[model samples]
Target: MTNTNSTKTIAVYGATGHTGGYLLAELRRRELTPVLVGRDADRLRTAATAADLADADIRVASLDDHDALVAAFRDADVVISSLPAYVDHGEAVLSAAIDADAHYTDLSGEQLFVRRVFEDYSARAEAAGITLVPAVTDSNLPGDLLGHLTSRRVDGAAEITISHHSRSGGDGSRGSAETVLASVDWFREGGWHYADSGWQTGRPPVAELRYPTEQPRPASKFPLTPVLTIPRHSAVSSVTGLLPTEFHEGLKKLTADVVAALPATPDPASDLHYDLVVDAEGSGKSVRGVLSGLDSYRDSALMAVEAAVRLAENTTKPGALAAAEAFDATDFLDALAPHGITWRIEEL
Candidate 1:
């Protein structure tokens, strides 16, 4: 890890988006200057100003413009990409990070994209001695924390399940909406599944467990954090993911209506608060952890920011990584405690 006083700079791509806005604020709060990069000049300027980072430089570039992206990354000690998970754009961002020879991190959950990077970019990043961490936010962090907690009790875990719940109030950002839509299309095509080969189709529902709550919400299958994290962690043989079936059905209903009313602005009435519960089981016993909070997008940005700052300070290893592999899991979770994000654990 590098010293805080080194005056090194970090660049944030997609700086004009909602999560990017919060990320910029976090950087400013830490007295770190972050270069804001986005396709929209006006929005970038506005976001930079809003973060009280008027002195920070704003660069205009899109994923299609390879040269501009490379230029934007040049000289950056670290590059934090809050870019939405568009298949094409995601690859371009990774290319830019490689071109710049800077450490890279992003909030992405696209399984295909993640696999490509792991297979293709991992060696490149290692050769450059720069880190490339994907799924740095909500998708993977909670499960990683759960894995860490479970390891203390058992030698290995056989299966794990993760579930998410959010209040229906806050609106999704443009980026989030796009990512969700893409994921929906992917799932519709049976693009994700678990198999003996790992994350393949034809695997049946792992299990249906009731969330330990007064409401006893039922969870449905979803592809997000666990699909990627479980395979990465050798302690676990397999992982399955779920979301409240009611929440999934509710979202499906809203998406149907929204699709019918295309070209019109999305209705914000369906937004809500969110929560997550993760359970891990092994040969002898099991452990469960719950993390409940508000504003999923904001929380994700906060997580990314804290992790990015830690990366900039060289508080973690310098090579290809993920949230659990790069940052100190316990320290990261402890930091979130002051932000109204609480985690409770139990042994069963």
Candidate 2:
């Protein structure tokens, strides 16, 4: 093993999972090799082969094995975890990363889990001089970035709302399905929105808005991670995100029938489409913006890998933070252009 500062060794926990496979492939495509860490050595080996990382180091460590996980990540400069339902398996991996003093990022979309990481781990990470960021993926960061940038366009932006719509050519991964299932309470209990000089809890009101597309689309209030992530940097007083009603209903159904397995992985060639719209309103002025992207999973991997690389190079700050807080949002978004994602912002 190489010393943490001497090499860019990235350790991937849950490397056998579907999203982890994409992460590994993205790392390799950047000419960087990642150390595969997971509970099952055989499964890790298989995934490594599929990612063309057959000769890369594979470390086995269960979430219950605290010391082992720490040891597995000890020499890594960065650790990217794809562990699903982060509320269950993420804490251990996060602890191990902090113990190793390695930067950490994950594919977490659950609002509560994202908040918990910052709430529970921020102090420890800050003390250890380690950076910890979650929801560094397609599901959250894109909207967060749009909101932050739009807020900049409108001086003294008092409130902001971001509407998200996504369509995938194939089914979601089992890990993603598991995450949605674990978020039942979050959906049921509703979520936090910045307002009245502080955070408040309640469901956001439903609203219909026209997207950049030719026709107006149906949009309703939905609790996505951006509601939590946006307030981390922007001065906006309120943040709300909305999704399609039927899609939100489908998530509720998936939560009830949690046992129904999702497809192992999205089609590699499948195009994941996204429309992110941000509206910021202030005392008398307002601004709106939109970002369209393709291949959610691929862009997510690119985002995570880019974050890892940046953190490894000491370009990002230490402590638990939103993606925009840790990196230049526009630069990060622009970096993924080669991966089939693009964005545009305009005043209204």
Candidate 3:
């Protein structure tokens, strides 16, 4: 709660989206200035007004307008890409942030987009002397950090198994709904996992999990984004990610009609909780790390903002990086405790 600053400015692209509203408020709550940047002038103005960011800057910039996008980010210490579908509309913003000399982070959870940032932008970001951290939301960040911790418990991690368990109190944001619906094609393919010394597709060697009081249940073999993220910074030989079978089916069920019926932004009354767990085993020992928090979308904003603020300090690893590589995993995780996030590691 003591992390407040008004001197540093953060430009938020897609400031009118469902998560954007929460992101803006968090920035202002920290006393950091927010620059509302997006394609729609009217919508940006409304979001700025709602956040009570009267003295904040509002720059209208479309992703395609490279010059405009660069100009929009020129005055900021860090840029938070708040877009719903990063795979579809992420590159331009990332590229522009590099051109503008601004540190960058985003709310991306898509495996493809996160991987793209690493493969395509790593060298460019290093050359620009700016950090680009993709997919630092509840999905990837916690697991990556926790996986690192869990791996450290043993001699080294031969493999790490990750899982996502989420609870939403009511109908969530329409943007989330639309994004999931749009991503149905490849999202279910269960993106790449590292094994046999390299990335692989199809069935992965995932260990059966019995987290805490819960029993091992049928989980859908889906892309656990950390599968792509963890190996980047950790010394793990293999990584696997999955979700509960019911959650996978629910993702398939999110139709356009259902998205239309959802709220434009997260309802203030509804509660959200997320738990990301990683089990790493090697050298005849096993350790598990769990990171839990409330309000998925809102806490995601906190994660992105924290990443941005940390990147602004210029202490993170330079270049496109995973959450663990971007910051001191233990320290960053500890800083989030005041925000209802609790984390721990234990040996079995």
Candidate 4:
């Protein structure tokens, strides 16, 4: 929480991954220097070349190595982690950030990891006075937007649903696939218990939803970070989310079709796209906000990088916080519009 007005160095872990590459590029575009970090020196070199950041400093560190991780964060003003969510490495990373007394942020959308960090790590972050922000990407951004709308309209929302759809050309990362599987396991284990005694196994199937102008489309239950975040922000009692069956089915088909598609392999170009539709029902009326875009996975990575830059620059809040709480939803969304994301609000 040392808020000094000066240019600061930021370190990016998993700098070779799909989102990591985009983040590294964004950092360069903003004229901010970022230290690329990963376990593999060769992959780090490849990423540096791909991002045209060959001159940027690079560090090699494994998450299991505490000394290495701490050394990686040394002298850095902020650290952005694009690592896999299920690894549950936030605790260790937070500890390193604390030891280094540097600001920390991540792009994790996993519910269990998020809960653990909020409950167990918040105090340490608060004590260090360093900002530990998580789920700053796809997980909580939609919820933040919905909360902002509800805050202004305050008749109190009854329910909110967020849906995602992808366009024809984009990419997927192995980290994203693993995250999806972990989320499925999370729901299947009766992890999401709503309203006391509402526990159930297996996620619900996508149901048909009617939009203002578009034809009815199927939206299936998808695990999103916002399910845990929106409750902390608005009077809304329930939050539900879905991933387009098109994407899910496509992944399923790919798994069965490609013999080389190992669970550990990265699919950086899966031709994926995504959109989010938030329906707020309150005040005896309902309205919907739709956010559609190409290259959602890449966009999420860019958003995380921007957020880390903002944190390092003292443009956002200090202390441990979630994505929805740390940044203004409208401002963030507006920033992305220039990147080819279409955000629209319609009355229903």
Better of 1 and 3 by TM-score: 3
lDDT tens per residue, model 3, 283-334: 8988889888887887888899888888877667679888888788999999
List the candidate 2 regions with Cα displacement exceeding 4 Å: 1-6, 169-171, 255-258, 267-271
lDDT of candidate model 4 versus the reference: 0.67
lDDT of 4 by residue, 1-348 (tens): 443657778888878777777788888888877787778988898888888886888888887888888888887888887877544665677678777778888888777787777777878777776788777665366555655564345365556666655543213555665665545555333244233223233554447765445678765566666666666656675566665555455545343224236534335445555666777777677777777666666677777877887777665555667566777777777887777876777667
- lDDT scores for all predictions? 0.69, 0.78, 0.81, 0.67
User: Poorest 10 consecutive residues of model 1 by lDDT?
Assistant: 259-268
User: Candidate 3: worst 10 consecutive residues by lDDT?
Assistant: 1-10
| Tens digit of per-residue lDDT, candidate 1, span 78-181 | 88888765454787877787788777888876666777777788888777767887776664676666665655555555566776665552245555655666
Q: What is the lDDT of candidate 1?
A: 0.69
Top model number, lDDT: 3
TM-score of every candidate relative to the true structure = 0.87, 0.92, 0.92, 0.84
- Assess the local accuracy of residue 196 in candidate 1 as a C-alpha lDDT between 0 and 100: 62
Reference-based lDDT, residue 50, model 2: 94
lDDT of 2 by residue, 187-252 (tens): 645566666766677765655766675466666666678888787788887887766666666655
Q: Between candidates 2 and 4, name the one with more favorable lDDT.
A: 2
Worst 10 residues of 2 by lDDT: 254-263
Error of 3 at 274 (Å): 2.1
